[model samples]
Target: MWLRVGSYPDRELAMEMASKLRNAGVRVEVKEYVEWDLTEKYLLKGKLGELEEYEEAQEWKRYADIIRELIRNGMEVEAFEREFLKRAMPEEFEIVEKARSDEITDDELVDAVDAMMKLSLLLSSVYGFLKANGIEVGEYIQGNLPEDPEIIIELDDWAEGCEKVYYLDFVPSYEISVDVLSAIRGGAEIHGMEGAVVDAASRVLMNLIAGIDETNDIEELKNYAVGVIEDSKEFDADVYVDAEEVFEIMLRSLEKAGVIRISGKKVKFRR
Candidate 1:
């Protein structure tokens, strides 16, 4: 997948940023977009596939595309069923064939199909919930079951009837520059500030880093940073004197440190 890392009105600047990141061992790509005869913008994107979950998503998408194509090619239901059985495990094929031949009546088949459709809808809802909660479907498939009994019951009911289930696990993924992480962890001076100020800035920076994955909008990140600072002030008012000002300063420092790039209304992480 290609993730937008930076945007610039000037093509040269965008390419320059891409080159810099590429030289630093990060995969980068630059593309140009033109407005309706008004303006042109350059976008810098980074390729992401380092995670097993990402790879799984890609493979799942490919498989879905293949199935879609097969359907579009006018495959009959019997042909499709044969194809499905060809791909099914031996035990699964036996169970499904037996159900079709002897175990399932006409009304029971209708009920089973209805339940399957309901289960599909339920899985879609679950997928959206997991994504919103920062979960990966591939990770969930690898033995990360939900803790809630109701959720487990729903899943088990569906899986018992259908003989298959898809799931995802919650795991927040964020990439931060090594230098920035080291500075934050080692308590290094940030733009000549130390102690509480550094701690506050580090906390805000980490939040911003995590937030950027969700949104690259500069204002959104700034607002999120201010929220973090405000939450911290509830504990130690002296640590953060001005949330907005502190966020601005930290953003500039991050830009100066080559950990991030700001262009117009967008902020992009280098990593």
Candidate 2:
């Protein structure tokens, strides 16, 4: 008999349940069971059965679709039981659908994508700034690059409850290119500003983008970035970050500090 081995609130969960049922000597099939208990996070009322013949299986599948529509529209177990109690199809069909509820349309996917793009662009700009400041922003990435540099990072969008968040996992032993490093290093070297934009951008990216989530004031983070670099005397991920992100942040900071006016990505330090 073709039997629904499991029912779930979501396709993934249903698949998992069906897999386990298959392993347990049962003919498992995944079915989307809706009309869940809002508080319990599981499907509430649904009918499932075993089909004995090919014709019967097709008929069951067709009937299940009608039931699916009912559940999706919010059916209650008590109401369904009261109605179906008079006519019993089978004992297993009396069983309630249960599984972790999930949304088919997760908005977190979009939010995560946007967040990552913003972060990547910010990182690239900051890295650029670091290079302008005489700091070797790409040194770490160049050193730690994986077997493949182009595929350096994997972007993941995840749901944190109802909200979607994005994160990046750098490829094994690889670093993201902070492309703005060269420009920022130049700015620092020409102006002799003591690590200059690189210093400022590094600290900001470390705190904001990197996992080092230290709460730092603008002045402190700027000093931290420069100090870490000057002391280490090499490209360091522990304190250093994508120089490009730092650059964008520094432009904003400098504008805020009245040290320069950043217009259309061109930050002109006031002479």
Candidate 3:
């Protein structure tokens, strides 16, 4: 997917110019990209840290910090341990042991790529299913509808049953479990294939993406992104998220703050 910078009447001429630039050793490669706005206090940091160190530091450092901060703030020992320390310490040890060395195995890298591909495909299928069923989904940050798009985060919040904080909305969009996807890929027969599996997967997905919309300041977005980075560090899996993708969904908040304007993948200061 080529990122179109500007459009001219002559498409051939543009391609020719691009080719000439590449021939002139400009290191040109074309790829598609998405733009989005973020909210919360973490998404605006604009950097994805080194994955190895990120993994090691987040589990131990963040766990210790949260615990220490809580205690320093005069929180009760039992409550602090139960709420944060106990949960963080075990996982910290597990992640530190698993990610102690910097080198990643080839199989682990391949698994990460495969998992991403499966998720992409599943999102595409879900988007199609929802659109066919007459549930309209608008792009959350861009404030527009995308054509032939996958992974449509809703622009508005809606409640499903008693849950009031279902910000990401879609109908007939089955939130399948990672296990089901893994099972199917592993050639295992999905038992109770119809309603049971679908409902379970949907429940899992809902829980995973469930959060209330907070169209607050960019500071909040930065904090939220930092939390995600720290959380990723605690896990055993390898996740290499790009800096832009991390904050794109939160760009709307920046725009809402009257600081900038976003056009496609390009952003600029508001006049």
- Candidates in order have lDDT scores of 0.45, 0.32, 0.34
Model 2 per-residue lDDT tens digits across residues 1-271: 1212112233444354334333333333333323422221211111223222223234334333333343344435445333332232332222222122332222332233334334334345334323333334321321221111111111133222223323343321111112223323233221112133334443443333232134223333343333334443333444433444344454465456455554553334455
Backbone clash total for model 2 is 28
In order of listing, the candidates' clash counts read 0, 28, 25
Scored against the true structure, residue 4 in model 1 reaches a CA lDDT of: 42
Candidate 2 lDDT score at position 61: 47
Which candidate model has the greater lDDT, 1 or 3? 1
Best by lDDT: 1
Tell me the TM-score of each prediction against the true structure: 0.26, 0.17, 0.17
The candidate with the higher lDDT, 2 or 3, is 3
Candidate with better TM-score, 1 vs 3: 1
